[model samples]
Target chain A: MTVVIGFEGSANKIGIGIIRDGEVLSNPRRTYITPPGEGFQPSDTARHHRSVILTVLKEALEQAGLKSSDIDCVAYTKGPGMGAPLVTVALVARTVAQLWGKPLVGVNHCIGHIEMGRLITKANNPTVLYVSGGNTQVIAYSERRYRIFGETIDIAVGNCLDRFARVIKISNDPSPGYNIEQMAKKGSQYVELPYTVKGMDVSFSGILSYIEEAANKMLGSRQCTAEDLCFSLQETVFAMLVEITERAMAHCSSQEVLIVGGVGCNLRLQEMMGVMCKERGAKLFATDERFCIDNGAMIAQAGWEMFRSGQVTELEDSWITQRYRTDEVEVTWRD
Target chain B: MTVLKRLGRRRLPIANKMAVPENDDQASKLEFSLDVPFPSARQAAVALGSLSPDREPRRGGVHKRLTLTGSVLNVKWRADEARVLRVSVNSFLDHLSLVLETMHAFSADVCEDPHVVLGHQPPSAT
Candidate 1:
């Protein structure tokens, strides 16, 4: 039984997971929310990583009833993230690897999500829709590569949500997306917003601006409730995404749809995708929080696969690449 | 993939640790300072073009100037106290490359007598 410890310090969430063979022994997560007026501060994220990484790692080990020495290898997110956050996680992983004398593997955060979705859903050829704070893409596996069928031309979907949340003074409690989802549940009227889809790419900036304007007008009139606006926004955006995903699935001729990334946990978006998939007689796979959002287990899972294929990064070979593309890396085990 | 290799090369340290002598002719000849923050690139060009009233090497050449027509941020570098290095793009690609190169060279002290290449636009005939 090979025990692998994974460290995830991407986005605002810090997650640690312990896996043995193909089973997840323990997966615990902690979210670092910026105080009410302050947005994502790099220094604050770094400090949080330094403080919580150890606790989460220890918790994972303790819950799994395994000693530090019991771990066979270690995995951590290498890049496609904020530099300070990635550096902090790298430092912790490097320290742990040095102390434990275990092989350290650096995993791509995006691919980790895709692989984890595969692990949970057992989908062989699923068209993936990965939407998160930093990324938005429709992916399909082909020729041993995950090709991007569609993606955001400008800002990410989750970034748009977070920015809108801030604009409306919504407390980013639990999570910004979750709060928006809750507010959307109570919303009634659907205010028309710009739905801009160019070719396979989508643009959210215009829609964001339009919503702010509409919200301001509503505020001036003192008529529509904020919940209704939130609901309308989610409906419009999710419908746009579902429309694109449906197009991609038709183009790819695939019967399975897997939604991964932080925004995948949004029930409304999942429901929209679910309806589309059902209409097309296609299967939709959504990961739970442990694997849905950023976490270490997925990194370890991908690392183990990479390790078996003899893909390893040298110590000097490691560096944080903020714009690392998901389709750039070669995956050997995909058919 | 070739683009990635070119990007990697551009990211490498430009020079090793060797400070530009204070009195060096070239060092004294060039003027370096941070560019002004503009609400957008088009607005900045309009501002700068109005202020200078002379043909200057538009930032990042015609392509970038065209690309950053409405960009929110841009970096302007002046070399040889004459040419303006307009490093602006719709995306962060060129800006990131320039910043990384500058930091690496500055740290290594090898960026003293740097040669600035103006992209796509020729120097204005004064």
Candidate 2:
């Protein structure tokens, strides 16, 4: 059994996961929750990760019940994330690999999400919609690369939701997007928000700006409740995403559609995608919070695949890349 | 096991060597020094390799150096102002704590000496 230990701190969530082959041995994570009306900064998020990462690592090893000798590889998210938090994780991953005498693999955070989704959902060669606070893209596997068919030209769909949550003074206890989903569920009215989907690419900054002003003015004048605003926002942006994803699905002409990212767990988005998948005669594969959110198991799972294909990152070349893209990696593990 | 001599473009002799050339000036007066104790010398070196890769691109007002003597990691920082000094020190401590905790976990189960892992042979085995 090939065993891999993964470290992930690309965002506010810091997770350590141990995986043996296709099975998850252990996955433990801690999120740096901020107060309402505020978002986490890079330095603050990094400090938080530095504090809890080792504790989570201890828990991961304890739960896995694997000796150091059993581990075959060490994996870490090499980024497309905040600089400081990414560095914190890379620092630990580098040191631990040295200490444990294992080979290191630098994993792309987006590919981590995709691989974990595929492993958990068993969706083979599906058109993937990866939406997170930092990224939004519709991807398909073609010719040894996950080619980006469509993506956001401005802010990501999840970032729009998060910034709108801040505008409404929503609690970030669990997550801003999760809270917004709950609020949207209670919403009765469908307020109109700008829908800006240009060809295959989508933009959300204009929508976010419009909604921020609308929420402030409407809340002040009781034009509509925050729930209504949330519902409107979800409906509008998810439609934009669904439109582009469906366009990608049409282009790829694939039968399966997989949703993978922090925002992929949103019931509304999943439900919306499900409708589109059903209409297009395709399948929708998604995971719950455990696998969907930024977690270490995803990284380990991806690393396991990479290492199995003879991919090993020399420690000196394992720098944390803040803008590592999804299409840059060669998918050696896949057909 | 690779030592990081290329934090910048240049190379150093040691595996875990990264140094910014010393600049002594009146403006660079704010200085701080810290000694972080680890269980072993190799662990300190691992900490050094782990933490020192984040060299600045001259955007900040801080300059720093990391060196390992025995099991203690020596950190000396010279910044242009007190604010820069404080920020640099705090960031260093945060990284140091992470390294220490990682050591606490793996140092017991894994061989304390990293060369053993790299060489794939215990000293006794050799």
Candidate 3:
């Protein structure tokens, strides 16, 4: 019975998760919400993370009802995130590992999502669609690696939605993306938008730019409502995601499709992917808001897999990297 | 002498260095020091090892060096401007605070002088 504690502050959210084998004893998180018309900056996000990281860690421990001695491994998101926020969490993880005298496992953020999804949904082998504010990729495992079959050529799908959210000046109380998703529910009109899907790769920047201009011209002119704009944007971007995901499913010839990331909580995206899965005689696996959004539990789950496979990060190699790729980590834990 | 209870942050602008603008128009000539206290020399060295890596986002504009003096972790920084110095120092403080708190929380288990901390200096560095 291996117990692991993981830290995640790679983005706007800072979370701590404690896992004992396949069971999550506790997972607590805090998100920094920015005002409307503004996005979170690296420094400000790190400050927010620093302020509550310890409290969250304490809460995680209390919730899990576990002491420091119970934990066998310390895990943290190592990369593929903002530099400042990534370092903020990695620093704490390193210090804690030293104090607790446990082995440190530096986890890749995307792999954390995939591993967590697998654990929660019990999807033995599935093609993964990883879409978050920071990344968008369709991945499949082959020969000891979660190879990237397709990815964003420009901006991520969630970034496109978030930038459009700012254009609309929507509330970021919970999240700009969540607000947009709610607004899209009320939208009836489907204003035409650009659809850019090149082969297996997808691009969202051009679509975002076009919609930004269209929203400005149309919103002030009383032609397009914010809801309609949101609906149009979601339909376009999610359609692009479904297209590439389905293509990856075909390429991998897999029977299951798993959606993992902050944006994976979107019902519309899941519904769309579900339809594709149904048509292809495939099963769709996705988690709710609790698991879909960035959390320390995901990192811990990924680290648990690696640690059980006899992998641990040395103190000298625990520094965070902003651009670590998904395919960089060898999936030693997998068959 | 009263030892600092918490890590103290101090920034000094080198007027002489600023008078010449060492490298091009913007040379990070500002410097700051952060002295973080730990329960043991071993823990102080652990903090140094944990933070020594990780290069700054912008090279040449900012530089950081971590050294250990017994039970205190001494961090020195050099930067091109007050803004640059503030950014780097702010980040360092965040890391240092976490280290101190974690050490304090787990104080019961850590043994004294268990491992040799790599970056150790004489008390003169203080």
User: TM-score for each prediction?
Assistant: 0.73, 0.87, 0.89
Residue A11, candidate 1: C-alpha displacement in angstroms: 1.4
lDDT of 2 by residue, A1-335 (tens): 79999999989999999999899999999999999999999999998997788789889988999777788999999888998899899988988888877899999999999999999999999999999999999999999999999999989888888898988899997999999999899999998988999999999999999988888799899989999998999999999999999999899889999999989999989999999899988999999999999999999999999999999998767878789999999999988
For candidate 2, the TM-score of chain A alone relative to the native chain A: 0.99
Model 1, range A94-176, lDDT digits (tens) per residue?
54554344777788888889988998889888999999888899999889788899999998898888888887888777778
Residue A262 in candidate 2, Cα distance off native in Å: 1.2
- DockQ versus reference, model 1: 0.02
- Is 1 or 3 the stronger prediction by DockQ? 3
- For candidate 3, the TM-score is 0.89
**Under CAPRI classification, how is model 3 graded?**
acceptable
What is the DockQ score, from 0 to 1, of model 3? 0.49
Query: Which lDDT values do the candidates have, in the order given?
Result: 0.70, 0.85, 0.85
Ranking by DockQ: 3, 2, 1
Runs off by more than 4 Å, candidate 1? B1-126
Model 3: residues with Cα > 4 Å off, grouped in runs: B1-39, B78-86, B105-126
Ranking by lDDT: 2, 3, 1
Clashing pairs in 1: A187-A228, B17-B108, B59-B86, B60-B86
Displacement of residue A61 (Cα, Å) in model 1 is 1.6
